[model samples]
Target: MNLTLSLAINGGTGTTKKRKQLLRDSIVVDDVMSCDGGDHHSRVVRLLQARERMMAKLEADDPRVAAAAPDDGSGGLRLMHLLLSSVAAAESGDAHAAAAALHEVWRRASFRGGDPAQRVAAYFADALASSRLVVRSSSSSPAAASAAPPTRAERFLAYTMFYQASPIYQLAHFTANQAIVEAFESGGRRRLHVVDFDVSYGFQWPSLIQSLSHAAAASTSRSNSHDDGDGDCAEPVSLRITGLGTSPDELRQTEARLARFASGCPNLRFQFEGIVDDGPDSGCIKVDDDATVVVNLVFPAAAQSSMTSSTREEECSALLARIRSLNPSLVFLVEKDGSGSGGNAKSRGRSSSVLPAFTASLRYFAAVFDSLHECLPADSAERLAIERNHLGTEICDAMASFADYNDNYGGGDDDHVAEPTATSWKQMMERAGLERVELSSRTVSQAKLLLKMKSGGCGGVGFRVIMEGEGGRAMSLGWRDRAQLITTTGWRSRRRSINKAFC
Candidate 1:
C-alpha cells in the first residue's frame, strides 16, 4: 500500500537525483519558512512547501513519525497536505502530478486492514484513467450519462465499509431503540407500528426488534406469574414494521432481513411490509388508530438536501407535516453533523460552492480516518477496502467537483445533497411542530459505551458525547474533539395556542 516505494522504483516521471532534490528543497524551506507579514501568494507557496515537508516526514522511518499517528492529528495533517497538494497541482495544470499525489493519498488511506491492497490499487488506477482530475458533470461524458445507478451489492459494500470506521449506525440504533422503548412504555397500545422512511438495508431495525421481543417475553413471564390460574393476563406486545424504499429489490431485501431477525423471538409477533414509493407524500404511509406508531427517520432521503433552498425547505416541511399527520408517538432523527451531502448549509448561496463542501468533507472524514487508523492495524484488508471504495471516492469526488460536488459525486441529482447541521435540523423539526425529546441519560451512556468498546484497543480515540444547548436536547457525537455526528429524538406535541386581541 505504500505508493512512495512503488513509485520510486517504477518508471515514475522524475529522475532519482531530481526527486531527491525536490525532497531536500522542500525540507530546507519548511525548516526556514515563517508566516510573518507575507502576501497571499507567498503565503500560499510557503504552505504548499510546508505540506511537501510534512508528506516527506510522514514517509520517514522515524519513531516520532509513527508515534504521531492519526489520533494525535499529525497523520491526519499529512493526509490533508497530500490532498491539498493534489488540488494545487491540478489547479496549476499538472494533471500527472495531481493524479500521482491523489494515488499516494489513497494508498496511505488504504492502510487499514480489509481487502488486498492490489484490489484497492486497481480501483484507484482505473478511476484515475476513466475520470479527469477535476470533477465533471454527468453531461460532460456520454458514458457517465448512460451509466446505471449503483447496484444493491455495490450499495451494501459501500455501506458496510463506511460503517467499519463510523459510529453513525450504532448511534442511530441506540436512539431509535430508546425512542421505541419510551413509546411502548408511555403509549396505551401494546401493538407497535414502526414506519421506517427509506429503510436502506434495514440494519437499524433488527436491534430494536430484538429488544422489543425480549421485553415482550419478560412481560409475558411476569404476567403468567401474576395469573390466578387464569387463561390470560394481557396480550403479548406485537411489532409491525413498515419499510419505505424506492427500489423493490432493496425493499424486499430489507423485509427479508427483518423477518429473519424477528423469527427468533417467539413471544413477540412481528410483521413486515415493504412499500415502494417516493416518500411520505406518496400516500403509502398509513396511520392505524389501534396501534402506537413510531416514525423512524434514520438518514431519510429528504434530510439529505440543502435546507437553504426554498423548494427543498417546502418539501421538507411538507414531508414533516405528513409524518405529523400520522400522529406517531415518536420520531427518531439521525444525521451526520459535518458538512457534505449530509450537512447543513449555513447560508443560501454557499451550499452550492465546491470549496465549502470540500472543506467540510475534509474535516468530517479526517476524524473518520483517524478513528479507523486507531481501531485497525495499518495492513488490515477491511480498512483498506473501506477507505478505498468509500471514503476515497468521497474525497476524490469533492476535489474534482468543488462546486456542485454532491450532485457530481452522486451522478447529477439533488437526492444526495450535503447533510445539515443539528441546529438546523432542530429548527426544521420545531417548525414542523415536533417538540424535542431530550435523549435519555441511558442512551447517552450506551453511546459512550459503544465508542469505548470500538476504540478500546486504540485508547478511546478521543470519542466524546455531549448534550448541547439549553435544556440539553441537542446530543452530538464527536471525534478528536470535533462533533461529526448529531442525533436526537422528538415527539409530536400539541400546538400552543396563540393569543390575539381585537384592534
Candidate 2:
C-alpha cells in the first residue's frame, strides 16, 4: 500500500526525472516564495525568534503535554479528527488519504473530547521522526542514513494556526454575523452551518459565537419594543451552527468556548457538530432555507505545495462548486501574502522530494519574527516580551532548531513572508463562482510594526489608529471578527447601503 500510494504521488514511471518533473509541475515552488538575492538575513533572524516564542507558548499551554494550560480546550473536535485521520491514513498506507480523512473525522467528532490538531501534529511529527530514522541499508553513508527529516510537523502546525489568526477570524465573523442577523431580522429564518477549515487552536470561532448571540438579541429586543399589537409579526430568528474541524479537541474546545458565550446571550441558540478527518467538501456548504454557511479555512494553494498536489485540485474545485451550488449569501476566503516575485514557481536543481508546505511556512514565519525584531524600533520590544510571557521565547528558537532538520532532510529554503493579501483566494473563490463583496488586509509588514510597538509596551493599538487617532477602530468596525476575501456579484449595493447608513 505504501508503494502504491507513493506511486500515486510520484506517478507510475520509475524514472527519477519523471518524478522530479511531476513534482515541479504539481507543486509550484514559486507560489511559496520568490528569492531575489536581496538581504534576507534580517528577515530570517526574526523568523527564528518568533518560532522560539511560539514553541514555548505551545509547550506551556497544551493541556495534555503540559502540567497546566491557560484554557480548558474542551471543544477541540477538529484536533481529534486530524489525529484519527492521520492514524487511519498511516495505517491505510496512503498519507494523502489519511490527511483527507481528517475532514469527516473533524465533522463528526464530539464537541467536548480530545484535541484533533495536537494529535495530528504529533502524528506528523512522529511520522517525520520515523522517516528520518529509517535506515534502509548499511551501504548508505552514516550521514545519509542517520540524517533527520525537516521539522515538517512544527511548520505545518504553526502555519495552519497562523493562516487563520485571531484577528482575521474576529474580522470575518463580525461581518458575516452582521449580515446574518440583518437577514434574520428581515423575516429571514435560516439554519446556518459554519464550517471552519484547519481549526488548529479553535481561537477563531469564539468571536463568531459572540456575534451571533448579539445579533439574535438585538433582533429580539427590537421586535419586542416595536411591536404595536401586530399579530402578523415576523418570526423569531433561529440559528444552528455546525462547525467542522480536523481535530476532536478543537471541536470540543469550540463547543466549550461557545457555550460560555451563549450563556450570556439567551436569545441565540446553537448546536455545534464536528466532522473528523475530512477536508472541506462541496456538499457541506450548500445553503438551503436561508442557510448561509461560511467556510473560513486558510490553506496554502494546493498548486504551491507537495502536501496538496494537482490531484487534490479536484477536491478544492468540488468544495467550491458545492458552495456555489448552494448559492449562499456570502463566502469569504483568506491566504497568506506571498512575495510578488514568481521564482517560487521555478524548480530547483535538486531532487523532487520536497518537505510539505506547512513545514516550510513555519520556518518562514519564524524568519519574519526574527527579522522584525532586528529592523523594528526598540520600543516594540514588548511585543516579543509579551509573546514570550503568553506563548514563549521558543517560538523563534524552534525554527532555528528545525532549520538544521530541513537541511538534513530534502527541504530547502523556500521560505518567505510577503505583505498579507487576498489575491490568490480571490481567484479561487471567483472560479468557484462566488461573487466579490468585500476585502480586508493586514500585511505582515504592518503586523510587524504593530508588534514592534506592542513590544515597546505601548499596549498595541488597532490598525485604524494611525488614521483615526489613538481611538481608531477597524475600518469595518462592526463587521465579522475574521478578515475576509469576499466576491459576490449584485450584492455590492446591499453592503454599500448598509455601510453608508451604519458608518
Candidate 3:
C-alpha cells in the first residue's frame, strides 16, 4: 500500500497517461505504513471550510455551482477536472495549489457520498489530505504521525469483504482450482496436496473442496478400490492442504473451519495440516510423492519488502525459484491491480516518476470505489467496513508515501508508461522457468457471471475480463472501459510439466 513500498505482482493498462493523462493502475499489496492521524482532525476540516467559501464565491456566476450540481449530471466533468488538476499539481510538488484544489474537491466530493463518483472523490480526498499532512509536518513531529496501523484481523476481515463484494479473490481461487483439477485428473491421482503460501482465513478452499466432491460424485464409473471393483461407486478423493499462517491460533481456527466444511462434502477425503509460516525454507513443506501438488500465490511477497528495485526483483526471482523447486503442477498468481500501465505493450518497458506513477494509480482505485457503489447498498455494514478498514487504509498508505516513492523503474519518455521492466511479475515467472498457461472457458465465464451478479446494477455495465500476454495467457478484472484492477495468471514449471507429459 505504501507508494514507497514498491508495487509488484500486478500488470495492465487502461489508457495512456501521456495522451489523456489517464494513469496506469499498478496492482500492489504491500503493508500499510503509519499515517499522520491528522487528516480527519479539526485542522483539515478547517482547510475544507475556507475552500468551500472561496469556491462559492468563484462559482457564483457560473451556472455549475455545487448547490445546483447533480453528482454525475451537470457537475461531473468539473468534479473530475478538479481531481485531475489536483493530482497534476500534487505530482509537481505544488502543495499550496494542490491543497486549494483538494479543499474544493473535498466539499463537493463530500456532497453525494453515496454516489459512486462522490465516493471516488471522497477516497481520493482522504489520500491527498493525508499526503498534504506529510508535506507540512516535514518529519520532526512525532505527534503528528501517531496514526495506528490496522491490525492483521482487520485486514483479514477486510479481505473477506473484498472477497464477497467483488470477484477479486474468487477469480484467483476459482481459476487455480481449474488447473488443480486438471493436474489431479491428468494423472488420475487419488490424492491432491495443495501448499498455500498464505492461508489467512482459509476462505479459498471451501469452494475447491465442494468442486472436488461434485467431480468425484459425477464420475460414477470411475474405479474405486473400496467398492469391490464394481465401479458403481466412486471412492472419496484425498485432499490434503498444507496451509501456512503467521499465527498458530489463526491456523487452528482455519483448520477447524475447513474441516467442518469438508465434512459436509461427500465422496471427499480432506485433511488440513497447518504450519507456522515464519518464512520457513520452501523445502520444508512436505509433499507425498504420490499426491499431485499445487501452489497458491494470492499476493505473493518475499518478506514485506522495502528494498531497492534490484533487491526487490532479486527477492521475487528467488521466491519464484523456490516455488519452481517445489515443482508445483501449477502456480496461481493473483494480485490487486492498483498501479502501472493498464495494458500498453509500448509502455511496458519504460521507467516512471514517483508522483506520476502514484497519481496515475488513482484511476484504478477510483473505478473500484465506484464499482462498489453498484455492488452493495450505501447502508450495508459490510460495505462500510470494506471502505473504512480495507480500501481506506490502502489509499492512505499509497498516497501518504507518494512524494517519497523513489525507485528506478527505468526511464523513458515522460508519458511512455513503463511497466517495471517488461512488467515485474511476468518477467520473473519466465526467468524462473515457469511457462504461462491459459485459464479455461469455464473460469472466464464464471468470472463474468460473478461480475454481473455482484454488480448487477446496470448489468455491472462495464466490468470485464481481458486476456493479455502472448497467446493471451493472463486475465484481468476491470471496471467500465478500463481493464485494470485485479490480475490473475496461471503457470507451470516448464521442466516438470514437459517431462511429465512425455512420460
Candidate 4:
C-alpha cells in the first residue's frame, strides 16, 4: 500500500525577514572553558597530564587497580586514559606516539563478550598503518589521504558504535518517547502518525511502538469495562510512520527495522513508509485529518546547511512553516548543546573562522569523554571502538576544519560552520509559528531516573528543565552542571489566543 504525505508551502509575500545575529566569540569560548577553568589548549594539556597520572597509577600495585578486572570500572578508566593520551599525542603532532598509545589501549582493553575487541584492534591497526605512512612520506611534500570517505556500511557502523559508548541517543530517545506517550494519551486519537526527520536506522521507534501497544491495550481494557456487559475489547490503534531520508537504501533499512518492531507489537495495527527527499517541502509530508501527528527531529537540523549558506534559519523556518501548516500535535527537537557554525541562527556569519567552533566542539566532547570514563570499563572493547570511530573522529574533524590542507583530512567545504544552541532553536521555532508546550513534571522526573539508571550508580550526570522564550522549554544533560546536550519540545497551539501570547 502506498502511503505518502505532503504539506503545502505558504507563498504569502511581504513577510518581514529578521536580521541574523551571531554568537559572541567570548561567550562561546568561555562557555566551553568554564567547565575546566581554562582554554582548549590548556584543557588538552591537563588531560594529557591526567593521563600520565593514570598511567603511573596503573603501573603501581594500587589496590583498586589490582582488584579491578579487565571489564570493571577501573579497567574502563585505564582504557579511557590511554585513549585520551593517544588523542592528545595525535593532536599535538606526535603521530607515532599516538600509534603507540592506541596499541596499549587495544592490548589493555578486554574483548571477552563481543566483537568490539576485534573492531577496536582493527581501528588501532589502521592508525598504526597511517602513522607509518606519515613517517615514510617526504617532510616537504603534502601527505596523501590515508582513507577514503566512509561507505554507507561504515557510516552505519560508526553511528551504532557511537550509541553504544554515549548516552546521547538514549537520552534523546527517552525524551522523544515521553513526548510521544504524552501526545498519544492526551489526544485520545485512535490513529497516530509519526513523521521522523532524517531517520537513521530507525533506532528511536521500537520503544515508542511498545509504549503505544501497551497504551492501546490499556485503553481497550477500560472501554470493555465501560461497555454494556460486553467482553469484546475496544478498537486497536492504527499507527502509520513516515520516515524521511536522502538515501533510498537507508530508508529501506529503517523500514525493515521498524517493520520487525511492529511485528512484535500485536496490540496495534502499524504501517511504515520511507520517503527520500532533500528537505521537508511540498508533496513530501501528508497529514490525515482524523490522526494526530507528531514530528520527531533528532539531531537532524545540524547538517541542513548548503554550500552557499551556513545559517539554518531559512531552512528551519521553511520546514517549520510547512510542519505548522499540518498542525502537528507535538514536535520533538533534540540538538547538541554548543554554538558551532553549522546548524541554526546562532551560527550565522561565523562560518569562515574555525577557532570558535573548534573550542566549542572540544568542550562538548570533553564532557562526553569524561562521562564515558566514569561509566565504562577499560577492558570494554566497545568503549574503545566507540571512542575511535565516534568521539575521536569528531575531535579530529573539528581540528581539521581549521587546517590549510583541510581537504586532505576529510574536511569538506562546509566543515567550518558552528553548531546550534538551544536558545537559537527556540527563536527559530517561535518564528515558525509554533509555541513551546511545557513538558510534564513527570517527564522531567522520568528523565532524571533514566540518567540515574544509565550512570551505573555513579551520580555523576545531572539534568535541569529550563523555560526559555515565552513557553518554550528545554532539558539539558550535563556533567557536574555543565550542559552537554539539550532536548527541546515544541507544540502547535490550537487556540489563536495562546499563540498570540508568545508573540
Candidate 5:
C-alpha cells in the first residue's frame, strides 16, 4: 500500500495536493481594526488579509466566540439577506452599496460567536470582501510575507477537534470500513490492504482495527470449539494501511498513534506505512497479489469540506483513474451530499467555480453552523477552536478565488457547482470502468446506529440516516429538512469477461 495526505486546499490540476500556503494568509484577518470597515483602506486590508489567509490556509472565526453578543433574533434570516445583497452588489459592481452591505454584515455578524448563521455570514463576508478586494497593491508590506505553514501539532489539533465535535469524520470512516469489511468477508479474503488517499491524523483506522480484531476473535473462538487440537484454526487476519500525508513528522506521529492503538487489538496483525503525497506518481503504489485491496477517499476534514471544493471533481476523477489502475476490491467514495440520480458531483464551490456553488455552500454551511449550537455549548473553547482553527479556514477558502485563478481555469461547464447539467461523479467512476457497489445492509444499519448515538446532540429524527439510490447502496446522513450533508457510496472494479475462444 502507498499514500499521501494532510488534506484541504487547492486540488490543482492532476492530483489532490495538500492545501499548502495558498490559503494560510488569506482569511485570517483581524476581525476588528482601527481602519473604517467601509473605506478603501479597509478594502485593501480585507483583500490583503483574505489573500494572505488564502496563502496561509486560514479560515473565518467561530460564531460561538461571539455568542455573548446579542443575537436580536437576527441570525438566520438577516444573515441570508445580507449575503444575498452582498452578492448582488458585488456582481453589479456597485462598490458603495457593496461596502455598506459588507459593513452592516461586519457590524452584525460575529466571527467568534455561537450563531451558525452569523458565522456563515462572516465567511460569506470574507468571500464578498475577497471578491471586491481583488487588486492587491504592489506596495503591500514586507510584513505581508506568508506566516510559516501550520505546524503538525496545529493540524493534528484541528483534525482532532472537528472529529470530536461532529460525526462527520466518524460517518465517513465507519461507513467506508463497513463496506470494506463486507467486501473482504464476502470475497473470502483474510488480508486487507487499505490505501487511504487522505490520511491526516490516522483517526479512521483505530476503529477499523478494533472491528477486524473482534471479528477475528469471534472467528477463532468458534473454530477452537470445533477443531480441538486437530488443526490450527486461528482466524488470523492481517491488515495494512498505506496513508498519504503532507509532512514526515505528522505522518510519523500518526503512524505511532495508530500503531499504539493497534497494539491492543490482540487478534489482528497490523502494518502501517506513511508516505508523502507529492513524492511520486502513477506507479508509486506497490500492490500485493495476496491481499484484498481497498481505496478510502475520505478527505482530511469536514463532512463535505473536500466535496464542495472547486477542483474536487477533476482531482478526484484523476485520483479514481489512478486507483482504477490498482483494481482494488472496493473503493469507498465518501462525500458531502448532493441531490441527483446520485453518485456524482463531489465538488460545489464559490471561487474557481460558479456563483450558484457559492450560494449552495452558503446555505449548507449555515445549517452546519446552526447544528453546532446543539452539539456544543456557546462558551465551549473546543467549539470555538473547531470553528475558527479548522472549519472557519475551510469555509473561508471555499470562497477564495485568487485574482488570476480564473485565468487558468477558463470557467468551463465542468466547474459548475451543483447545476442540473453538471458532469456527475457517477459518470466519472463508470468511465473509469468501476461499477457502483451497493452499501450493504450492515453498512446502512451501522450508519443509522451512529446517528442514533449522537442524535441527542443535534435533536432526534432530524439527523436520521437513509439508504439512497436504487436498492439503497448509497447511505446519507443529514440534518432535518435540508440537504443530506454526507453520503457514502461503494464501488468495485468491473470484472472483465472471459474470452469466448478460450471457453
Candidate 6:
C-alpha cells in the first residue's frame, strides 16, 4: 500500500537559481498568444500591462488597496473595471495605459487566485467579465493544488515546533486513525481505546471523524435503503475514543472536543488521558485479552524519536513488546519515512552548501527575478504575476513550498525520509506478533483524487489493512504495509443511529 504524503518547508527561504529554472521548465505550455491590433489585442495588452504595474506596486509594498483607493463594493466590480481598463489600453495602442492596467491586474490577481492555477484563471476570467470582456471560464484548463492544507511556517521556527508541525506528522495521525477503524470493523468491537503516543494539535482525528461519518452515513443509508438484509448487509458499530498525550493542555483541548461530540451521541465516548512526560512506558494502558482495541500512535524513527522521550527505539520496542503480549485486535505503526530532513540545511543550523545559504534569505526575491526571466506568454505572465502579488508573500511562499513538495521540485538534496511502507509496517506488526488483515492506501494529489484509500495492500479502501486478531478466538490485526493514516471513524449498522452519532 502506498501512503500519500506531503512536506512543509520553512517559509520564505530562497530557492536556488537552478531550482527556479527547473520550476519554469516543469510547467507545460497550454496555448499561444493570439493578440491582434483590435479590441482583443488591446484587452490582452491592457491585461499584461496591468500585471506589470501591479507587480511593481506589490514590490514596493504599496498599500493603495487595488490600485488607488479600493471601495467597499470592490468584491468583483472593481476588479472588472481594472481588468477592462487594461484591455482597452492595450488594444487601443495606448502602451502606457495598457502597461498600467496589466500591472494592476497582475498585482491583484494573485491574492484573488487562492494559490491554484484554476482559481487564478477563474479570478482573471471574472475580472475580464467585470471589465465587460464577457470571457468564459471553460476556455482554460485546470491547475494543480496542494493536497495538504496550507499553514504558516513561522510556527515551526524551533526544531521541536518544526518536527511537530511537519506534514508527515499529520500523516502519522492518519495512519493511527485508519488502523483503529479497520480493527474495530474486523474485531466486531463496539468501542476502541486509542493510545496516542503524541497528540500534537490532534490534526488526524478530525479527518477520521469526517471520513467515518461520511462513509458510515453513506454506507448505512445506501444499505438500508437498497440492501434487503441479504448477504450484502454491512453491520455498523459505535466507537469509544481515548486519546493519550503528554501535555495536559493538549489533553484538555482533546477533552473539550470529546465534550462537544458527546452532546449529540451518548454511546460514543471520547476521552483524553494525560500521561507523564517519560519514555514510552504504557502508563495506564495494558495489553489484555479483552474485546478492546489497543494501538500506539507514536513514531520511533531516529529523526522523530528525538522529538519525544517516549518515542525512542528502546522505549518503542518495550511498548510494542507489551502490546504484542496483550495481543490487540491490531497494531498500527508509523514513523518518519527515512531519517534526516533531506534538505541541505539542518534544523536551526547552517546549510550543506554556502551558495544556498548565502542566497537563502532572498529566496522570494530570487523567485521574482526568475518569474520575470521566464517571460510567460504576454497574457499568461501578466496573469501569473498579478496574482502572485495580490496573494502576498506569506501566502505565496506557503503555496510555492507546497508546489515544490507536491512536484518534488526544490531543495538541494533528494534524500527524503520515507514514511513506513506497507511491506515494512506489515513486517513490523508480524514481528511483534500481529497478523495482517486488510490494507488500503492513497496518494494526495490535486491532479488526481485529493485523497482516497484503496483496499487490499497496494490498493484497498483508504488504508493498508483491516486485520482480524489471530489465535482463532480473537486474531490480532495489523497492516502488512507501513502506512500513515489520514482519516478515522466508526462504522454504524443503522442509518438513523449514524445520523444521530454525527449530526
In terms of lDDT, the best-performing candidate is 5
The parts of candidate 3 lying over 4 Å away from their true place are 1-105, 128-133, 136-158, 218-235, 246-248, 275-283, 302-308, 339-352, 378-381, 400-422, 452-458, 469-472, 497-503
lDDT of 1 by residue, 138-252 (tens): 2222322354545547657877866656675677677668867777778866889888877778888778777887888888889888888957856777889888788888888
Best by TM-score: 5
> Model 1 segments beyond 4 Å from truth?
1-151, 154-158, 161-166, 279-283, 306-308, 342-352, 392-423, 496-503
Candidate 4 lDDT tens digits, 1-503:
00000112222221111000111211222233223334435544543444443333322312222223243322433443444455445443455555565555555543232333223323332333344221222221111144454556765787786665556677788888888878877887889998887677888888888988898888888888788884677888888998878788888888888888898887799989888766554235666778878888887644323222333556666676666765778888777643233332224333332323333343345445545554566476656556655654554443333342222332333323233233355666776767778777777777777776766633354333443444436665555445334545656644332121000
lDDT of 6: 0.35
- How many clashes in each candidate? 25, 130, 16, 15, 41, 67
**Which candidate do you rate higher for lDDT, 3 or 4?**
3
Candidate 3 worst ten-residue window by lDDT: 25-34
Q: What is the overall TM-score of model 5 with all chains considered together?
A: 0.73
- Residue 184's lDDT in candidate 5: 79
Off by over 4 Å in 2: 1-191, 229-236, 279-287, 299-305, 338-427, 440-503
Residue ranges of candidate 5 with Cα displaced over 4 Å: 1-75, 84-98, 127-155, 228-230, 233-235, 279-283, 300-314, 338-353, 401-404, 410-423, 496-503
lDDT of each: 0.55, 0.35, 0.58, 0.53, 0.59, 0.35
* C-alpha TM-scores of all predictions: 0.69, 0.44, 0.69, 0.63, 0.73, 0.37
Model 1 root mean square deviation, Cα atoms? 10.0
Q: For candidate 1, what is the lDDT?
A: 0.55
Residue-by-residue lDDT tens digits, candidate 6, 1-503: 01111122212212233223322422121012234446555444444444333323222331121223223222222333344343334333344543444444444444333223223323443333223222222222122122122233322222223223222243445545655666656665545555555655455565555555555556667777876667564444344454555667666766676556544543233445555445444355543234455555444322222111122334445655655444455555443222221111111121111111111212222222222222223345443433343323323333233223223322323222122112223333445555533334331121012123222212233223222223211111122222222212111111111111100
Q: 1-503, model 5: which lDDT tens digit per residue? A: 00000113433431112122211211222222224535534444443333333222211122221222233534344444445444433433345545665666666676665556666677567555654332222232121223243455665687687787777678888888888888878867789989887787888888889999999999999989989688998868999998888778878988999999999998899999887887236226766777888888874222233233445455656676667766788888777542211123334334323334444455456656666666777787777767666666665465554222334543434322233234356777788788887777778788888888877765556566757779887777666544466677888888642221100
Q: What is candidate 5's local distance difference test score?
A: 0.59
